[model samples]
Target: MRIVVCVKQVPGTHDAKIDPETKRIIREGIKVVINPFDTYAIEAAVQIKEEIGGEVIVLSMGPSRAITVLREGITVGADRGILLSDRAFGGSDTWATSYALSRAIETIGDVDLVICGKQAIDGDTAQVGPGIAAHLSWPQATYVMDIADINSGSLTARRMHEDGWDLCAVKLPAVITVVKDINQPRVPTLKGRLAAEKQEIPIWKAADIGADPERLGLNGSPTRVVKTNPPQGRMKKSVVLDGPVEQSVRRLVQELRQRSLV
Candidate 1:
């Protein structure tokens, strides 16, 4: 089984700049961390590999510095890493981003399964995984809480939803996006850390992946960001509780009821 996990480098701070033309985050020269949710995807892939004896390869699409997140995945048990980076990939919306990723996966050859986080904190779009599935024409299950079984030809997992969750089975060579509730991520061992430090990742350009230039970046993206405004500040309301605890609780409940908070 060859499991490819797609990870991302997202801004660490909430203060992010957007390209008004593309409606995408300007990731250049900003402090970044591994997309927090991607860690779970990495963990899930690593765990699956360990359980069944396979390789976990981490993939990412970003600038050169984004390779850091790939290396981080290697330290936590990914076998190797690949980066999809090129000037043409700049300012890609989720659709374009997912298309590039699907092409990268195709370049990697035989992959039994693809895993990713449900969403990136920076974008909060939650569309890339499903988008990749669409581009690849493979089955997809999103918001997966736990994978119950995996075999040579298929996989079964519990998919989470608004009301509840249901077990779903899909054929191999499928895509799935995981939520944070899946598993606890393991820390990188000293040996794994050393290996990650020395790993030389190969960077693939759009041409390298045989991706169409017309569908590579901002030009391929149909969505545009006309304007972006910072979120308005929320007003703080202070409620003072007086007298006994029970009285305070009652008063708070009454206040909440009045405000339709309950």
Candidate 2:
């Protein structure tokens, strides 16, 4: 089995600044880390590979510095890493981003499965994984909490839902977005880190992945951020509801009513 795990580099801090002009996060000068969710995806892929004896390849699309996350995946267990980076891929929305990633997967060829995190913290849209599935015209199971079974032809996964999870069986070459509940990520050993540091990850440009020029970058992005505003600060006022249980309940309700928060 040749499993591909998709990872992303995201701003490490919650206080990431937004570019007023572009209405996008200003990533420059800020510390970047692997998306927390992607780590679970990596762990899932690694476990799958270890269980059945196959190779796991980590893939990402971002600036050159994004290579760090790819190497990080390698340190955990992935056999190799590939990066998709170029000026053309700049400012790509989820749609365009998934398209480019799908193209890269096609270039890799003969892939058995693709796994990704449920969402990226910075965006939180949770659309890219399904978008990739759509672009590839393959079956997809999102919010996967576990892999129940696997083989060369198909795999069974437990898809998480609001109430609970249900088993989903899909054919080979499918895509799945894993939730953190899937597994705990393994720490990179010193030896693994050294090997990852020495590994040369190939960076693929738009042309290398055969991505359509018209379907990349800002021009190809169907969605645009018209404006952005920071979340309004919460009220700092506090109320102490003391006395008997009924009194406290009544007081709380009164306070809530006064604040129009009931």
Candidate 3:
């Protein structure tokens, strides 16, 4: 089993600003951190590798600074890391982003599984994982909560839905987007950190991945953000009434009814 975990470097602060022209989050100068949700994916990949006796590789696409997140993955038990970075790869939306990653994965050769977080906090679309699967033409399971079984190049898992979870079975070479409920991510160990420091991560560009220029970066993305603004803040406050418990409940219900909250 050769498992590849897809990770991302995202803005660490909530105060990240957006580019008015592009309507994309302004990344320059913002502190970058590994997407928190992706840590669970990483953890799941490591566990799968440990159980199945295979290698785990972490892959990410971003600016040169994104290498930090790849190295961080190595420190958390990934065997190696790959960074797909180039100026031409900038301003990629989920569609183009997945295309780039899919190409990179192809360049890496044999892979049994791909794991990713359910979504990135900065962009809550939750589209990249499935998009990559589409590009790779592989089966995908999103919002996966647990891996029930893995054997003979097949996987059985539980996928979370609005009402309940559904059991799904997929062949090998599949993509899975995991939620935080999947597992608790572990901290990097001393040895893992040292190994990560000594590791030399390879960076790939569009040419390296044999990507079509017309299908990558901002130009390839069909969807564009036309406008962005912070949601207006609420100004109302709750009032406590001094009365019997039942009376308080009645008052609260009446207030809710008046406001159509129910």
Q: Each candidate's lDDT (Cα)?
A: 0.93, 0.93, 0.91
Clashing pairs in 2: none
- Model 2, 62-148: lDDT tens digits are 999999999999999999999999999989999999999999999999999999999999999999999999999999999999899
Off by over 4 Å in 2: 240-250, 257-262
Writing each residue's lDDT as its tens digit, candidate 3 over 1-262 gives 8889999999986668898888988888889999998999999999988897788899999888898999899999899999999877888989999999999889989988999999998898899999999999999999999999987589999999999999999998899999999999998899998899999999888899999998888888898888998888776685988899999999999999999999
- Clash count, predicted structure 3: 0
Candidate 3, residue 243: Cα displacement in angstroms equals: 8.0
TM-score between candidate 3 and the true structure: 0.94
Per-residue lDDT, model 3, residue 183, is: 94
Residue 133 in candidate 1, Cα distance off native in Å = 0.9
Q: Is candidate 1 or candidate 3 better by TM-score?
A: 3
Instruction: Give the candidates in order of lDDT, highest first.
Output: 2, 1, 3
Between candidates 1 and 2, name the one with more favorable lDDT.
Answer: 2
Candidate 1, residues 75-185, lDDT tens digits: the string is: 999999999999999878888999999999999989989999999998899999999999999999999999999998999999999999999999988999999999999
**Each model's backbone clash number:** 0, 0, 0
